[model samples]
Target: MKTLLLSLKDVEQALSMEEVISAVEQGYISYNEGKVQQPDIVSMEMPENNGETDIKSCYNKLNESISVKIASGFYDNGKNNELPTMIGTILLFDGRNGAPLCIMDGSLITGIRTGAAGAISSKLLARKDSKVVAVFGAGGQARMQIYALCQVMNIQEIRVYSEYTEELPKYKEYVERNTKVKVIICDTPEQAMKDADIAISTTPSKKYLVDKSLVKPGTHIVAVGADMAGKNEWDPEIFKGAKIVNDSIAQCISRGETRNAIISGIIKESDIYAEIGELLLGNKPLRESDDEITIFDTTGMGIQDNVTAAQVYEIAKKKGLGKYFEFI
Candidate 1:
């Protein structure tokens, strides 16, 4: 009566950022090759928060589903110290037999995989000569975003902004010693975003933190926040001007930042240029000009979780890492 058990802390020790990116890429390839299945991202409305949205996606591509729940103003309620406000789980299933594979820590896996997704997207979509990177939201996810970008680009500066105020200065210190780039904590999100070669938003906000008017033409934006229906980071006008890239359009529309823009009539379905995999696989094209803005709206792909979890499972299984017990 024994089964393998893995904890969140255990998963953290088992995987690295580079490995997560590789696994996510596998899920991406599986998706493109018609080897995966992903259910549409479905939205659930919350009663008290008009702007609150919860979205879930089950990926056939990686036999995974990522459910992200967003609740804004929870910090405003003076309960900011409890469990993390943005909370959810990623379920991983065995691809070959559909057995429940491993349930690792979602938040940690999220930080790694989502950041890797941005890194991989930038690898395929960002300009080859890009230099500066700016990130919005100075939380843990924001830190990881900067970490991932550093893996793929030789960034000159990193501008960080957060409405949270207290986190920015600490974030600046964390990046300075860890990275070779110049780290600046901006007073406003707009100040961080403008004229940057690459931009990433990791906030869970209902309103747009990135205005279309502020973006420099040809800037590559990888937006990771606003996965829920009512939550969004980039303005709809931004969608109008840029060539949009997504992980999956169907999943993107229900829970991703792109979903908000489409829901509000800011962009059309036909506007999406292609999935990031398409570009990586050579099925689509990259930026043709230095003036056309490109946005990668990421809604945590399932394959990302599946591949990463699968890797963790193999390593943990071999190491005799987790306690085992029989489930049935």
Candidate 2:
């Protein structure tokens, strides 16, 4: 048997947000149907070095494929080493016989599929006429989140907030060039969040950035930053009155935004409305009314990584984009 080795450029050329969203949605469906075997994420944190790594894996029974991903984030890498803050790799294997299939870059897959998770949440939870967007981050994930949302919703105006004020215009220009959505730079995070139909937070801030007071009723907040313990973005108080949907109830309670809320006594485990997978399976209802405030807390599921990487691997193979090596 031969294993394929794919590069970052190859993965990027083979995958798109639209296709990833579709693939990820199926992952959620399979998860809800009890067809995916996913374990708790393994986390390694180094506070002294300002770095962390997470190992995730899952077996998709429906597709008979498995993927294991290792992703790392070193916040000071850009300042100290001029490297990207996040890096990752994925290994794809055949579930039927445990044969190695592909080894590929996972950073691009992570960003795109994380964005796809947000898009899936918005499609099911956001109001039907949602047009204006408030995005709190100017990084790669932020761009991809907006890209995925635009694929599913009719986003017209976008308000972006970033600590790096100068990067906002360049990001704005990039978005305008790639998408028809108009982008505005906000002086404050509050300025970006006010009266917005949808808000996405993609930063890795230790402290809460979005205040509960700034969020209006009917707003759908996609909290994507709080994927690890001690990483949070939204105020826990927001959960007191909002309907909370997390990617995984267990994952969220331990490391997602819901963890902070639960720790602060603002909410409890029973307060959770349902997992996004449950909503996808029609086991729970979506936003009951346009006036309801809904929050989707995504911690990035292993099943998502497995299915998305599988899709990318297949596409790259069919396109003859990567190198193949025989080992067994």
Query: What's the TM-score of every candidate structure?
Result: 0.87, 0.97
Per-residue CA lDDT of model 1 for 33-97, tens digit only, reads 88765555455655554333333444453444332222232333325355564454554554455
Question: Model 1, stretches more than 4 Å misplaced?
Answer: 42-82, 86-91, 95-98
> Model 1 Cα RMSD, Å?
3.4
For candidate 2, lDDT tens digit of each residue in 176-201?
88888899899998889866999999
Q: Backbone collision count in every prediction?
A: 12, 0
Residue 320 alpha-carbon offset, candidate 2, angstroms: 0.7
Q: Give me the runs in candidate 2 sitting further than 4 Å from their true place.
A: none
